[model samples]
Target: MDMSETSQPTIDEVDLLLANARLRDELEPYRDESIDTSTGRMNLRTENEYLASMLAWERAPALPIASWFTPVLELPPPDSLDDDSLNELLSATIEKLYSQKVVLRFTDHLSNRELYKIIYRDILPCCEKKVEIPGKFLEWRCFEDTDTWLRYYADAVERRRYQEEHDVRMPPSERPKYRRDLPH
Candidate 1:
């Protein structure tokens, strides 16, 4: 192979550049994060991925969090009718939120009814901001006050684990990393 072939990126550079360009094409799209992908080209695939993620987050739509829980969403809030009603509502809620690129975390403490109430009263207020772009989402922090939620709500196993890990016996935040990607 010629020195240029090894020293410079091949046509694969065009593919990476094109993929980056596609990011912006979704909604009048515009973006680029190129990986040389050529052998001995100082692998930039990881960096490119990170840069692409950062760019998406920077350009994503900013919407109030409450909009996510509105009745207008794909799944409506659960009715407080019967025993199974709350669970059904929660199942639907998780699915709808996931589809909309929302994730909830650190919520082992609250019962189904309580969790729903917070979504209705607190999350539905739509005051908090969330960044949502294609392949990205806005993470809304849930009830994660260590002094309160963790102290009172955490189960014995969770509390013991937390104590063992931190020694401070308190969570860094009542909720941690609310906006998380689905487990890959």
Candidate 2:
């Protein structure tokens, strides 16, 4: 039997299940809290925490999902500033990308052409810089030529992986399971 030929549920189906599970878990907390009269009017911090936890739970798995949903761009920082300033700009850009879940696909062994594509096609046009790297790697005049961009990208990737693992490792009871095929 050719396993490759076997039909499998689409991402939409899995997404539906995930959505249901999220709702179920979110509601469960509210239901449990409703029993306690003293739990009325949740504080801002508490509310924020609850929302954060719920969101984390929901988005933990299937990270880099933004790559699928959002358009990719490659734009670099402005060249008018000195190397130090450029590094700062690059750091800020990396942070913004991480927060926004933008995937920066680059490897340590990236060629100048590859770097240019990432800069011009993905990072530059969308971001402020629009600067291109003339060398194989970003030269670090201050500390070391440690491709800070790649570091940030790796961090984002690792964060997603950790979240995905956490989601999978969560106890079945703690994680809500909903059957999509069932009538609502």
Best by TM-score: 1
After TM-score superposition, what is the CA distance of residue 33 in candidate 2 from its true location, in Å?
47
What would the per-residue lDDT of candidate 2 be over residues 102-171, giving only the tens digit for each residue? Answer: 4343233343343333443444333232122222222211112233332333365654565586653322
Please list the C-alpha lDDT of all candidates, in the order they appear. 0.57, 0.40
lDDT of 2 at 59: 44
Q: Give candidate 2's error at residue 133 in angstroms.
A: 33
Candidate 1 has which clashing residue pairs, if any? 24-29, 24-30, 25-29, 66-126, 144-174, 144-175, 145-174
The C-alpha stretches of model 2 lying farther than 4 A from their native spots are: 1-77, 110-117, 124-184
Alpha carbon lDDT of residue 161, candidate 2?
69
Determine which window of 10 residues in candidate 1 has minimal summed lDDT: 175-184
Q: What is the C-alpha lDDT profile of model 1 across 16-113, one tens digit per residue?
A: 76765554344243433443222343345544565566555556555655465565543345464454877677667666766666676545556677
C-alpha root-mean-square deviation, each candidate: 8.4, 23.3
- Name the top lDDT candidate: 1
